[model samples]
Target: MIPRVPRLQVTELVLDNCRSSNGEIEGLNDSFKELQFLSMANVELTSLAKLPTLSKLRKLELSDNVISGGLEVLAERCPNLTYLNLSGNKIKDLGTVEALQNLKNLKSLDLFNCEITNLEDYRDSIFELLQQITYLDGFDQEDNEAPDSEDDDDEGDEDDDDDENEAGPPGEYEEDDDEDDGASDLGEGEEEEEVGLSYLMKEEIQDEEDDDDYVEGGDEEEEAEGVRGEKRKREPEDEGEEEED
Candidate 1:
């Protein structure tokens, strides 16, 4: 069955791992004239001789292909391309990649798992050749934008230390505990003093009752003495009256 093709403007095309060759790209014809993004990864591509001319191409992913050369062709054809993924290819030499320096607007390049990635100082060499690249092998290798993981870790540790400092020391908690204990003890002492004062007041009340009883006994004795003296004076008056009669 003939497949139905959409009657729309094609801006992006992806044929990853489709076992496509240069013939498939060549057959794209003018239908993809406005294509800005293309991905043909793992498609066994060996050359760019018959690749369609995509003047407005901005990103290309040709990773995992058998492409050993022709980076210059891509740079010349896709001058406006900014991002390229050529990882996992048969690129054995940096010489082929040096040709991509012509892509003045190139910002990101991925050469991971490629033969050229094994070369010593390979990243430095690439950065030297492609000064405009901001990312290499999926990592930001730009001088100013490079991430300092160690510095970030140190800053995190310093922040943790600052938090601990703000929480104060263990000694302060111990001092607070001591102060609370002292206050509790002082309250207990005040309660004991109050109890003692109450006991003393009870004893004072008992002593006042005993003193009142002694004063009552003394008044009764004085009354008895006055009655006895009056009886003696009356007996003497009776003896005088009998003698007068």
Candidate 2:
């Protein structure tokens, strides 16, 4: 047993499999003025005579019931209905579905497993009869797949995409920072190599200067020895001249 909720606040209701011989549920009436969606499948409902007038109702599901006729009440009661499911019911012919033509806002209708589906040119005839319906039995007139009733989910997915797009620039900025860090590290390494090569060149120049100084000192010593040899030869020549005299 479901507890009674505040009728004014109720926007959606599901009473599937709740037995109601005359298609009326206790406490369900025009008092639920805000109701937008309703499901009463498998409820043993034989008629829509007792159904409430819900001007804002957009979706109604009465599948797997004994609802043989009286669909005209739907247009009068729920004029704004955008979707209606009468599958597995006793709808037998196109005329039975013609009652829905008054529902100008109806976009989709499902009558699967009904006797009317077995008729020749069923899909074509229905599309022709209900020109406003975009989908019959879950397909469009062009045989294209119909859109599902997950509008909120689609909005959520679009929000997620927007969030990702909003955060994209920050994510790219972080990657750019990482690249700049890498370039800074390479610059530091190059600086270190330059410092090391500068030290090595300084050491090589100092060693060359020391070698030049050593070579100059050795040449001065050899020149002094040659002068000393010339003086010795002159002294011997002078002694030989005195002896000859």
Candidate 3:
């Protein structure tokens, strides 16, 4: 027997492969008042007569069992069940599956590997009969895939959180803008320095040209002075020759 705890606080229970019927478990019905999920898969349960009245139960697993009929008890005991897996069971006929119609809250049901699945119009008939169910086995009436399990949902939630964290705070974008601005300013400063250097080079070239012109002018003035001196000496010699004559 499973050890007892605060059973009323229990929201989930798994008795899979226990080789016992629902009635065999002591205090399952009375103890688990808050139970919302239950799994009795492969437990060799032939009937649900002794199943607990779990109005809060939303999901139940009874796969791979010998349960052939008497599914109406589920509608009575777990009226709020949204998901039920009765796959790999002995359910053979559409009439037997019709018993689930009473479960108004049932949105998903699995009867895979069952004899009923081999029926000619099994998929069509089940959809027509259970109009409220969004998924039969794993597909909807329109053949759309069903949503993933809760564990997958949790993983998706974690991925979303990681994405949010990777995105970082809003201020991060502002920091990037500031860095771009700094780079732009640095580039402009470099451009200004290049221009200043070009201007200085032009000034130096102009000064060099002026110095060359000054040197040429000085040479020309010295040549003119030398010519005047020669002319003066020649005039003096001419006067002396005339006197001698």
Q: Which candidate has the top score in TM-score?
A: 2
Q: What tens-digit string does per-residue lDDT give for candidate 1 at 32-150?
A: 77888889888888887766667888889988888888888877677888789999888988789988989988888889889998899898988888999888876766545433343
TM-score, one value per model: 0.54, 0.64, 0.61
Comparing 1 with 3 on lDDT, the higher-scoring candidate is: 3
What is candidate 1's local distance difference test score?
0.82
Model 2: per-residue lDDT, tens digit, 48-77? 888889999999999998888998999989
Position 153, candidate 2: lDDT = 68
Q: What lDDT does each candidate get?
A: 0.82, 0.91, 0.88
Q: lDDT score, residue 86, model 2? A: 98
Model 1 CA deviation exceeding 4 Å by range: 1-8, 21-26, 142-245
Positional deviation of residue 141's Cα in model 2 after best superposition, in angstroms: 2.4
Clashes of 2: 0
